[model samples]
Target: MQLTRFTDIGLRIVMRLAVAGEQPSDTTPMTTKDLARELAVPYTHVAKVVGRLAEMGAVHSRRGRAGGLAITDLGREAQIGWLARTLEGPGEVVDCEGSQPCPLRSACRLRGALARAQRAFFDSLDEHTVADLVRDPTGAVLLSLSPPPPAPPTDDAPGNRHLPQHR
Candidate 1:
């Protein structure tokens, strides 16, 4: 199923934040312009989606040079299917619109079948989270944003298990 622009951008926003979280030292939250550029979308579009996400408590936003967005803990842990449901609205997939009410409206099997298909689609997506999306090793989006692997442990390092007793 094709997602609406709003839902698509919302998903992108979450994934972007997920990628940001993957950064070991990249503490600066992304500005709307930066996110827009990264996603190849208009700045205004990102702002609008950011507003919606902020209102939902999925993101935290502030205004100013130091202000930007960071995904909320709730957002980081959000399930893909749940986010889609919120963005898409919990509405019936097929409307019974016609020039006049169709005679089969009441006993329509198509509606039931369509509903089942929708459920199955979402069920599959439920198996994934925003975390899983960015964890796709084959994709460079998150990889490009990630920091270098941390150095290996050393005996003299803080919290090193092999440190000699000095007491």
Candidate 2:
């Protein structure tokens, strides 16, 4: 079963956060803008997914200068299947109840088979966690995408003009 774009983005976000969480120095929370830029996804889309992740207790968000987004421990340890299911919601792979309802809705073996296939897909995912998705090379790549922390002001910097000079 193909994963929806929404679930795909959500998974990417979680994986990136999990990678960051593994690196103490990289634990600085990332803003939605940063995540969007890094993932090459639209800001609005990332924002929406971030909101849902926060609701799931998989992501933590804080507002203000020092506030940003971070993956919670729950997010890092969450089973991939459970997270995917949460992101995917309760929609069938094949829409039997659309405006033009399927004529075979009442007697469709296909629907049952598709449902079983979907379950198998998720069950396979259950074997992994966000951390599992970012081991070694993958984790390194995701960590490389993180924005560097702001540089501290030096004595000669414009913002440090108020500081007393030490010869």
Candidate 3:
């Protein structure tokens, strides 16, 4: 269930930008060389993935004296969604509702367990915007990239009543 290098590198590039936020005028637009230097990835590899992300509207690239890359809102959102899906094992899980039944269907608990866990994972992610991811890229640096935590229930009353349940 490992993420493809393409997705992995693209996510790294986005994280770098997210962490960088608004680029400093002194900091020239990041070239593939700059990304390579900072992230330790080869320029060629990063370029392809980065280009793909741009094609997908996940990034915006400019050409000229200050030509470089920056994150777009769409790119940021796509990156966050991409990371969430990858961490949850992406294509490795089957939705079991109508697919071919596995031989272990009668005994395998992993499927149901993972399905419940995946739903919860996505539910938690739905609470976050890409801005959150940009702010906390380091939160995942040396640790596992788990799903975002479920947001604490909001207090809506003087007695500290929880917010209304979401459907």
lDDT agreement with native, every candidate: 0.79, 0.90, 0.64
TM-score, predicted candidate 3 vs. hidden true structure: 0.54
Ordered list by lDDT, greatest first: 2, 1, 3
Candidate maximizing lDDT: 2
Residue range with the least summed lDDT across 10 consecutive positions in model 2: 19-28
lDDT of 3 by residue, 70-160 (tens): 8787766653655556433444356554567677777889887876876665666567656566564563461233234456756764656
| Candidate 1 local lDDT, residue 13 | 85
lDDT of 2 by residue, 1-167 (tens): 88889999999999988876566776567889989988888899999999999999999999999999888999999999999999999988899999999999999999999999999999999999998888888989998884555578788898777877689
What's the best-to-worst order under TM-score?
2, 1, 3
Lowest summed-lDDT stretch of 10 residues in model 3?
Answer: 139-148
Give the per-residue lDDT digits (tens) of candidate 1, residues 1-167: 66689899999888887667455767777888878877777789899989988988888999998888898888878888888878888766777665776678889998888888888877788888887787767245544643345588787777987666898
- Per-model clash counts, in order, read 0, 0, 1
> How big is the positional error of residue 86 in model 1, measured in Å on the Cα after superposition?
0.4
Q: Distance (Å) between predicted and true CA of 166, model 3?
A: 77
lDDT value for model 2: 0.90
- What is residue 42's positional error in candidate 2, in angstroms? 0.5
